[model samples]
Target: MGKPGFERAHHVAFFDAMATELPGDYDKQEVNHLTLSYFALGGLSLLRELDRVNKDEIARWVLSFQVHPEAHTDVDSGLFYGFCGSRSTQFPLSNVKDPCHNGSHLASTYSALAILKIVGYDLANVDSKALLQSMKKLQQPDGSFMPIHIGAETDLRFVYCAAAICSMLDDWTGMDKLKAKEYILNCQSYDGGFGMVPGSESHGGGTFCAVAALHLMGFIQVDLASNLNDSASIDMRMLLEWCLQRQVNDGGFQGRRNKASDTCYAFWVGGVLKIIGAYHLIDRCALREFLLTCQSPYGGFTKFPFDRIPDIYHSYYGLAALSLLEEEGLEPLSVELGILSSAL
Candidate 1:
């Protein structure tokens, strides 16, 4: 068979189906429905097939998950007045007196805002003052963020989410920039890759979260692979090398040391390289071939190449990786924002 090309029409149909309603397998993830939609909607946007979705309806659906405080003063009640993951988590304000039980999440907030922008919703109407003011409550003294105000992990992931949320809203008040920067800086592994938290093993997702968070927070400069400036906070040379070494013989990128190449890492690792301006160094032909193997014949991508089924998460990152590679007919992405450039 000829070299597998970007199955544009099939992929569009794939995301279109998911956008209409996610498959039953995802029912267990009902709480994260908005996040799943971001992946599908983002995939459709990458394929230049956004016309398939109704912008107003999707925007309203996403907005419905947002949790606003009862009053402006409630921003200080230590509750996160951000977006919840889905309808189930959207607790009534009357029943949400406990900050810990409030269903709004940092990650969901990021996804909610992304979907809003994807649908061209006017975020100016969003309760920025409340969202930003309350989001600060989720930040710890160490500068990391918990996904929720309650029992949740604080790591580079939520930090990135918060940073993206603030960046999208065109306001930095949502997070303390200096503290977040310090927290992100502490995550860098000695090998030059970043971990989810200080003293953890380097990971592809964590590295992307750290780098992209730094980019959004203005702690690091872009295209460091080409510019090579001394003013950079992290070990630039080592960071670039660590990112470059992720491409294995199969041409797909791996998440961590000695791991199998996964579909999502293509975007996770490749996005870091792109931000550092080192993408031109990749084995483009081989990487494309590797990613094509993961393309599910039914549409979308799977974490592994031989997997039978497709998942919205891997599928979205697959398109994201292709967008980073500038694949023909796909929309370019804002790497840090994780959305269409036009959407911004």
Candidate 2:
């Protein structure tokens, strides 16, 4: 068969369906509605068809998730003043007395901000001060951030989300960068890849979070030589080598050693290489061909070529990986931010 071509119209329809209404199979994603919105909105932005959505309506829906301090007076009341993951997670305006029902999450907040920016909404109306206050409370003594104020898994993922939130708001006051840097450094495994936490096994997603967080914190200087090695500096060369190794003979990247390559790692691992300024080291043609194999006949990309089912997460990252390759007709993606250059 000829090289798999992009099904532009079908992909557009896929995103449009997500924007308007999610299918029944997506009911499980109701808790992470903001994340779903991000994937959908980010996909549209990548397709250069963000104009297809009602920007004002989408922006308003996103803002509605924001928590207000004046709404509750309980101990946990001010804990979640950022943004909730979905409408179901949000406390109704009339029920401001119940703080237990309202909880803002770091990842959801990050997605909210990203979606807002992608839709061309000026964040002037965002309650930056309140959001920053919430972010500060989420950071533990160890410098890792919990996904929500109520306490949850603290890992590199939420750390990256906190960093991305602060970067978007142009406020470093939300997190202690020095402590965050220390935590990130500790998460770097002996193999040169980063893990979710100290002493954890190295993984692609964890490495991306750590690297992108450091870059957002201004700890990773772009001018730093990739070959430079010092006791105080991260070994960029070793990290780059580890990332490159994830791209197996199949051309697609695997999240971990001895694992099958997945579509998402194309961005997870590829984004890391791009951030390190060593993306040219990869086999671009083979990687592109591998990604094409994962593209579903219906429109979006699947997790693996044989999976046959497409999802928003893999689809967005697939497009992003293609963007990093400077694929024709695709917008350039900001590796660190994981959004289209135009969106940025």
How many steric clashes between backbone atoms does each model show? 1, 0
In candidate 2, how many Å is residue 15 off?
1.9
Residue-wise C-alpha lDDT for candidate 1, range 1-344, written one tens digit per residue: 67777888879989999988888999899988888989989999999888987899888788888887665445787878888998888778677565467789998999999989988998998888989998998999999998887758899999999999999999998889889988988999999999999999999999999888888877666655334774247887888889889999999999998899999999999998887777788888888888988999988999988687999999999989988888998999999899999988
Pick out the ten consecutive residues of candidate 2 with the lowest summed lDDT.
223-232
Q: Write the per-residue lDDT of candidate 2 for residues 9-60, one digit (tens) a residue.
A: 7777777777777678888888899998899889888888888889999999
The TM-score of candidate 1 is: 0.96
lDDT of 2: 0.84
In lDDT terms, how accurate is model 1?
A: 0.88
TM-score of 2: 0.94
What lDDT does each candidate get?
Answer: 0.88, 0.84
lDDT, residue 178, model 1: 87
Candidate 1: misplaced stretches above 4 Å? Answer: 95-100, 225-227
